[model samples]
Target: VRDVSEGEACPTESGFIADQDRETIVKSSMLPHDSAPRVTSPAADEGSMQHNISELTALCTSLQRKYSELQAKFQAQEEEIVKLKDRVKVLEDREGVAAKQSRDDAPIKGGVSMQGRQLLKESVMTQRRLQGF
Candidate 1:
């Protein structure tokens, strides 16, 4: 083992740090399992990664289902809005027709009673005499 002083360049070999440090730090040639018992095994790491992937996939699936449900609900609400708009239009058209029919059924001014027209003519003649016309 060689001593690695501060600011000193440690020896290296083809993509591997040579055994220079006194501490048993992991090297390229040494597998993680071959290190001290504190090191995590490659299989354990692989299993953990797989577990994380599975959890993510499940979360994605759940989110997708929720999105689909919300989309369907949104579509249904849109359809309901359209139906309500159509109903409003129909009601408005019916109101318009009722208003027109009421106007048509009501008496015209020319169809006033003879007594009512005579009173209007007398009033107009009195107003003309007062104005000397």
Candidate 2:
């Protein structure tokens, strides 16, 4: 290898190499305009967000009240149904008792003690005694 000279440029096997002092600088340019980008007011935006949240909260509250009312109505209807079922059971029991009483009394019709029949016999005896007198 020969000693490099300061006045001469160095040549590589793949041709001349790029100089370190000379570099290709990358730069970009933007268009200048009068108006700037849009900017929203913080106060107005916060007020709108608050109003929307309040509306949603009111809707939720109303829905909660409606749900409570519907649940109460359902419970009342269930209680009413239970009461009606109990009444029906009582009525059926009364009908069974009446049926049993009638069945038991059916065979004792001739052996019945009737006050009207006793009074009729007493009246006939009194009439016979009066006719004999």
Model 2 scores worst on lDDT over the 10 consecutive residues at: 20-29
lDDT of each: 0.81, 0.78
Model 2 regions lying over 4 Å from their true place: 1-39, 107-133
Kindly list the per-residue Cα lDDT of model 1 for residues 28-71, writing each as its tens digit.
44744644457788999999999999999999999999999999
Question: What is the C-alpha lDDT profile of model 2 across 1-133, one tens digit per residue?
Answer: 4457755546674443343223322122243454888777999999999999999999999999999999999999999999999999999999999999866765555755455567778999999999994
Q: How close is every model to the real structure, measured as TM-score?
A: 0.52, 0.49
- Best model number under TM-score: 1
Models, CA RMSD each: 12.4, 23.2
Q: lDDT score, residue 114, model 1?
A: 57
Question: How close to the true structure is residue 122 of candidate 1, measured as C-alpha lDDT?
Answer: 100
What lDDT does model 1 reach? 0.81
